[model samples]
Target chain A: MKQYKHHTLSVLVENKAGVLSRIAGLFARRGFNIYSLAVAPTDDQKFSQITIVVDVQSAPLEQITKQLFKLINVVKISELDPATSCEYELILAKINAPGNNRASIIELVQLFGGKIVDIGISQLTVMLADSPTKVDDFEALLEPYGIIEVQRTGRVALAKQETSSAKLRSISGKVS
Target chain B: MELTGAQALIKSLEAQGVEVIFGIPGGAILPVYDPLIDSPLRHILVRHEQGAGHMAEGYAHVSGRPGVAMVTSGPAATNIVTALADAYMDSIPMVCITGQVALGSIGTDAFQEADTTGITMSVTKHNWLVTSAQDIPRIIKEAFHVATTGRPGPVLVDIPKDVSNQLMQWYWPDEVDMPGYKPTVKGHPKMIKQAAKLILEAKKPVIYAGGGIIRAGASDQLKTLAELISSPVATTLMGRGCFPDEHELAMGMPGMHGTYTAVTAIQKADLLIALGVRFDDRVTGKISSFAPNAKVIHVDIDPAELGKVRHPEVPIVGDVGYVLTELIKEIKNLEKKQDQSDKSAWLKQIKDWQIRFPLTYDKEQTKVIKPQFVVETLSANTPEDTIVVSGVGQHQMFATQYWKFNRPNQWVNSGGLGTMGFAIPAAIGAKVANPSAMVWAIDGDGCFQMTAQELVTASSEKIPIKVAILNNAYLGMVRQWQEMFYEERYSEVYLSPDLPDYVKWAEAMGCVGFRVESPDEVAIVIEKANAINDRPVVIDFRTDSSEKVYPMVPSGASNDDIVVDPSQGQGGM
Candidate 1:
């Protein structure tokens, strides 16, 4: 179980009122630590997709998915593997960038595929949407410029397409 | 037919085969009650919403059907939360309908308005807050479906006052289409075979049966499997009557207050066939050290239960009844016959422990009536099919300890949540479920006082559920814990026995009441309580408060270190 570290789960649920509450409530009641969650309606308006990343340190992955499956609104649960899953987080940071350090910060932002969303005389509001690891690196690189304020969105994820079709079922617990 | 949502709700309930409902009506739900006057559903008005919820639970526990409860918005819904939690914990099938404020006033904090769906999200298995009158029939259908199927639990449906009054074309859904909620009712063939192989090969195997056997109606299969394999069956507190206490392979109950033989059998077992049981802390003292030598074969309708506690070598996610049937078939196909001599050594060891530390109390010398003796006499006097309901406490343990249950669903108690006031109302519901069967509620003084007012409802309804109050006048279980762990520093445990004057209180509720003290009066009072059929009866038996439940595992200690009765010697064994 230690080797299976990616705890992100892609859950498809009926787009109904209180669906999110039900899923969130289950975690609270069972004491499962969910570190990140993102919800959005699917193309089929009646359904919604919720990407949840639980703290593996607190709860087992099997228990989390099994409990989620018990929810009547939940349609499907796919535990996204880090190696075969595409995951990304969006971070918006207001970084101090005076004339002296402006060019360097701009260059660094470009290196990380980030864009300066807003520009002021002494600060630049930059936004980056990339893998969590890349987002972390970009934040670190812009730290010297003295970040004024920063906001980070919970991660949203999907399994990689044409990844040589691996069995998504976890071998950790005996399912049969 | 065009009908109000309230009318559709009542009509849908009737369509669902809901014969009776235990509930209380209030402002938000006034419109619903109007339609109820003409509906075929017989509504039992309860003193409190919690009573209604528990009565529904009691009904479901005995009938294997979803117990239906309805309450108004705000505090009324909040009041029934305990019962829903109790039902959720024990997996009782229950459908609770709550009336919400008018749709426009929902978030505005109108009078009696509550976020019932939000509040009950954690407690209930599933819930619906109706956004339209059109969705009433479909949602009600889904509510009952979710509540009754796939590891049954309490589900709530909150309809606003306006929706109940709004007119809509009444149409019942022909089928339930919740694709995500398919419960695996049959075990995998391979897993069943593996479980059979394990059971057949193990020298010492113990069936750790739980309430699932009763819920799944699998006791017949359980008996067949236990007999075929010659394995001992240890029923959990929730699994009280799943296996007959009188059976040769029966290990009684296994847990904190479990019998010496039952607790020790699991500790010494090589294989544990845990059916519908979650290795709860009370049952498995220290999870790290519980059943250390045993390889587990877990079966339950809820897959999450498998590998949630003690990991099983063969985790079969299916209904216990279906799994037992398959395992029995697999065992028969794989093995020729089970030789009784194969498990003779294990049986002999269990018998030795049973003889050395059988449950005993000193009634020969005690001047006052012993609570255990009262239960024994009550069990002896009552009909064999009598349904015994108990509240949580020492009396709860005593009732199950003394009662010899030979069939399933004969005993009802709050096992998971340990709700104190469960017995009286639950017994009423049980009586309603089986009107001809004798229903007795054995309650502690502390527990009885919590829901004694429900006796009024029983009297008015003519439920005729007999109740025995073991009046120790103290919170006996708490006192025992304080004496053992808190150095006898009693803190607010004592309740004056004579203060409420329960006999007079019972009379106030329009029921026959009696108070007994001497041991000689026990049998006579029990017989008198048994004879009452016109209305409910209450007997206040003054019991010794100092008595404690024995064979305690001492909270988180290994089952190997069980503390037997002090009188048994060997340092309380």
Candidate 2:
């Protein structure tokens, strides 16, 4: 049996019409499954960054990267390792906070560093921005409180910055 | 200088060194045509938009330049979709300029309006829709640049009528600034050295060259590498003419319907050096069993092709010519002398296979002309530098099998797409590109009727290419499949010879036509057709309808299960 794992790739592409569709079409045509996707404008208006989470077998991962590079619109790609990257997801949960469960729900949200963004007569909308694991745990904790609706912004990640000393050492080593 | 968008477009094409264009003008593209009247570029008016696209492909295939095609909006754009798909599949470099409806009425279902870019998005490498006249010069430059670089394929640029009529200051961009579009042209030195080491160590190695060799003009480098290592070379259908067929080490084509020696050599090899080949399904039967014993060294311009189907031990991404040049240098630098005695046995085995099951067909058994005989005879009679083109099917197989291609780009056909109706226009395009050389479109009867209307274009344009129609009176390849697999239940494959007399049809199209029914008249008719240099000529050779392409490996079947002759037995010898 083939083992499947999650991979996060940050793809920088030209900011142009149909560029997104071209990338999506390539993934679809090549039978690569995307678990989550987020696209946003980068610092430079000429380029856009797309963060995609894919569940693929290890053997085909290399091929997927090569195929992504084939798309002319794709500028650069960097595969982020979960161990070294800061990953986060945002989730909005609308829960039925009738009376007794409201206090427990608020307590759970506070524990998970969530905030109550909206309150109604019988419902409370809580927003959580944290790591994927923390978001999952928060969702599970509010499940007993009769969660009415849930929406998740898929995973976005960035590598942790290196120490200034390490960077300076590498620069000096290169010069030597 | 201030100029209309159409004028700027023509000037940009001229600046790109475009010598000719293939197209048919219509209402949406009338503005572009007005400027074309005074331009120095020659335009061959085609009967169908698809013909224009295919003509451009043929010209590009031989000239190593991006061919240009122009057409109007809606139906014209839609008609050229097949050609774009063909070019895409084959990785031919082409630029298709399509006229779109005015910007104001783009989505309003205006007359002659279609979503040109939307329909062609997947088929083309990249496409654009120009909303402003100022964008014309840059778009044209980018289209050519994108189409001709990195794993070349067709690109389409659609200009609206209003945009074409708009005025703008014309200036060509000094450089294309696409950050995402850099293609690696040189292979890594370490990988090349590793590949050379593998080549030097292997006892039985074979070079599997493909269409990329021709595209990169790396045939000379390929030959040098093969000679340096004393290895046999086999070309895929797309790589037929990349190596001279007459070379001693040449194992003609390998795969279904390929020469037995070529197919067996690849199957039995220990190391396969695959150059610019995608390991297409047709070339690698039952991928699991294909070259099972071989550790492959795959080199190509497209990184996607490295492990798409078959994984390679060494995957080098670069242009074929550059890689081969580096590889040869690396091998020389390594100072590894290949033991000729170690490979003598392998060469002997390949030669034995070649002598045992050479490409042969029964010609003397029947009075009716065999298609192979026709192809063989035609190949023998043609000039040394002749360019042979063919449509898809039995005739295509026969031409690829029997024709002795002595030079690169000498054999042109739709190898990847298997598109019929490609021959007539493609031959004209080849002739247009090489006016002094002989160009022949060897086609089947069924395929001839598809785009035969292009013969009129050839005649009117004064491109006198020769057409050899193997009149088998049926869809030969499909009929053969039905005969072998479907219990001989012949479907709607037959076409009566007398229904539409090919000779008469050719005459009607202002071409000199002749008919040959017997073997005795084949040479005479071909000679006569070759002599007529003023107008396009068509020779209808009525070949045996029952003739089938041999050396068959049923689709999805292993190469070990190849049947040399179905009449003898279904079992492999």
**DockQ values per model:** 0.74, 0.41
TM-score of chain B of each: 0.98, 0.98
Worst 10 residues of 2 chain B by lDDT: B564-573
Candidate 2 local lDDT, A13-132, one digit each (tens): 999888888888878877888889999999999999999887776337777888788777899998877776788999999999988788888888898889999998899999999998
Q: Give the distance in Å from residue B313's predicted Cα in candidate 1 to where it truly belongs.
A: 0.9
- What lDDT score goes with residue B298 in model 1? 95
Clashing pairs in 2: none
Candidate 1 lDDT over B341-433, as tens digits, reads 388899888888888889888868569788899999999888989999999999999998888988899999999999999999999999999
Predicted model with the maximum TM-score? 1
Q: Name the top DockQ candidate.
A: 1
lDDT of 1 at B418: 95
Please give, for residues B263-358, the per-residue lDDT of candidate 2 as tens digits. 888888999999999999988998999989999999999988887889889989899999999898888877646433378888899888888788
Stretches > 4 Å off in candidate 1: A1-6, A163-174, B337-341, B571-573
